[model samples]
Target: MTLLLLLDDPAQPGVVELQSLTDDGLPEGSVSVAADDLASAVREREADRPRWVWDDTSRRYPPLLAAGVRVERCHDLRLCHAILRRSVYSQSSTLAGAPPGPWDGPREPPPVEGSLFDDVGPSVVADPLAELREQLAAVAGADEPGRLRLLLAAESTGALIAAEMQRDGMPWSVETHDALLVSLLGERPRSGRPPKLEALADEVRAALGQPSLNLDSQPDLLRGLRAAGCDVESTRTWEIKALEHPVRDPLLAYKKLSRLLSANGWAWMEAWVHDGRFRPDYVPGGVVTGRWATSGGGALQLPASIRAAVRADPGWKLVVADAAQLEPRVLAAMSGDTAMAAAGRKADLYQGVVDAGIVETRSEAKYAMLGAIYGATTGPSAVLMPRLTRAYPHAVALVEAGARAGERGDVVSTWLGRTSPRPDAAWQAEHAAASAEGAGADDVRAARRRGRDWGRFTRNFIVQGTAAEWALCWMASLRRRLLELDGRPHLVFFLHDEVMVHAPAEVADEVAVAMRSSAVEAGRLLFGATPVEFALNVAVVDSYDQAK
Candidate 1:
């Protein structure tokens, strides 16, 4: 059964309308419930295990979670609509050709005082039922309906997981965090930079022979560096590291400390951590390639120096797991490259490449494989590309094909049906001007450079996008498995290709098994019966830093 959940009416400020439907989305029955009774109504209906279809999971699920109610499955209409409205496979569907509507904007947060539909107007009245039917038609008429269906399901499941993870929050230790900060930064100051950071800035200024140089200002620092006999164009670490000068060490130290202090310093702990948990606002499908993005907290960019603060609660453990060589394994599976799959069979893919005599060392293999997916044109990656191509032609060919398609201003789809957006009008205009009669050499050069840059984006897009799909499937499977366990073993944090589950110590070992098996299931879901192995390094630890 499919339950279409929506606001009751614009006049009814705090009522909800629930319409029951068959699997094909045909209406069967309906009910209206007040906002105050929503949790009980939902809980009652959940006994049937119906897949709840709502406008946005973030807006609908969070309230129920707060009431201590959880659902087994849901279909997030907003997320599904986004997928169907742009997917190449659904080009002929009406939803794809329709003009932008209310479904296109950012999701609304759950109302704190009134009904979600109270502000609905004639122009903005987006009926969830109408959108649901259109999405169903689009997926039904898609070229690869099976793949599209899987992508939508995985994407919607991701939305639910994001909300649940936010509700549960990652276990955090504020005391450990403050101690680590003090140890590295020499005490949090009342109104300025910490002592160690200030001292490093002073050292940099003295070495550069500028007593009043503003270390915080890049332009001023770059001018000071140049005046001190250093020919550098930028303050990037790579550029500064190559120059030999007294200012080098001090400037690098200052920059590193500055980042640590600014990114996840004492101020961050006070704002994000609450009680014993760190809750980050996760934005699903936030990246164009389908990777998640944090709206405020630096969840994705958790620094290694302070990971020790991610301590498990009493009698609980953090089961951390991350896939090795994720992109390459994804490339192998999606392309159906049996040879590449064989290389990674029961072993590290990079090491497998070395054993296969493709490259002399593991580092070279790493560079070459990453170079292929990321479209590297120079340096060690370019040097090692030929050998890698010769060894794994099928895998190389897949990314190369995507690059060619992007250069032609065409869209490319991932293993599932998430398509890369077409180049904008400005990009088209640039290409047109370069191709005009008697075009300048400079114009042609600029056009070629821009084309290569976009090509690189599309080349990585296919692999990265598919890898993200795999991750969604992995988490979805693991989510179900964790619910089957005896204790409260729930996912609390997730970075791309890595996840941390907070579970009882007695169930930590079970969590490890679930993590491994779910990885296999994710692979099978994405690529059925493939030889590729999506191996994970599962570690049961007391703190995030303890994991490899």
Candidate 2:
């Protein structure tokens, strides 16, 4: 009744049969052990049975026994079967020097066993219930929570979702709304001359208090108007006027135009909300810097039409707040540029840099300072680099150090654990070769490129990642407070710098308090009790634009 087993290496195609044992006489219980441990167990069993004789010539053996000579029914039947099967196969393969046959390789291991009895012996295991309970407790006790908020104008939810899906690499299509007011209006070409859509424009412009209303000069100006009241035609007119404004900068202008043409575009977006609640598609990992993405509707790119559509639920008011020059302020704090930090603390950092005699003009200061931090070498950076080096020597040096580190192929981490991936060896080698060439036209160009790339990486890794962390904390706090409040106001939207909550008209003040508290808590969590502050504007309206 001796049985033989064969085993093989899949990669090598080599087989081995290493041992033999009896079938019914094999170890008796259901317990199993790894094949490697079989030899030790057999030897241990033999130590207790010194008088028992084993025949080397025949491939058969007697039953195993412990030292007491009591027939040890303690034999693990499954373990013995597997071990013998593997050993026989391994030995057979070694003898054959070929791949194992169909019945050759090691058999799958037996299922694990456990017992209900607690005091059965040392073999009994403890239940995982206690461990699970501890895990639940830890989860409850952890103060930090991670979640995302997406604030989109009720009308732009579709575009936001589409954009978010695009960012997430998800395939999606935009829905066309033929009956939407924008489509109907846009389809009819304004008479031989463009209509005095300026009145509608004037109303919206006056509402937002923006001076630029020359439709020829400000195309897409309608995108800026808020939908304060529910006059649908007026809302459509405001959006169209904004969209029609001529953009002086071609690139910026194109973006404005594209936003209008995309299906579920700015115009159609005005109709997709349920009771004025626009739920934009939120792609959590949309931005490379951990910012959220909106899909179908340009949720992130709030058009005037959509903004006008954001209305406070009856009895509630919309409270809007935004970080002033958030990135620059963050950069100042992170780089420990005391001067820069002080400037940010007082007024706009860019303007402060200009006043400090860093550059001759505001534009120069902005470009050079931003370029210095962001590794901008072309266009704006090219014009501003020298000014930045002269004005803020220490700030320039800090970013330069980061750039140097990046050029050497080091991965940089933010103040938090978030890290940037290391540059490939190819990039490093190219940079080194460029550096070795020494200041020729090509060499200078290469050097600038390398420096700029590195600076850009370092700049964003710190500012953007930290900003994302701050945002996550803020959202978490707001969520918690919302849960605590009695009136169940729903969080309808979250944009990078803003949040929109839909609440009853009566609880508008309460919601505003909650929003402000969340921002303050977020600031404290990230920067400690610093003097960082935010300004908010609140309004009640039937449309998004009216709230502003």
List per-candidate RMSD values in Å: 1.9, 21.8
Q: Model 2 — TM-score against the truth?
A: 0.50
Cα lDDT of model 1 by residue, 139-257, tens digit:
88999999999999899999999989988999999999999999999988998889999999899989988999998999999999999999999999999999999989988988998
Best by TM-score: 1
On the 0 to 100 scale, the lDDT of residue 162 in model 1 is 94
Candidate 2, residues 336-412, lDDT tens digits: the string is 66676665654466676767766667777677766765777689777778766665566677667777676566655
Q: Name the top lDDT candidate.
A: 1
**RMSD in angstroms, candidate 1?**
1.9
Backbone clash total, candidate 1: 0
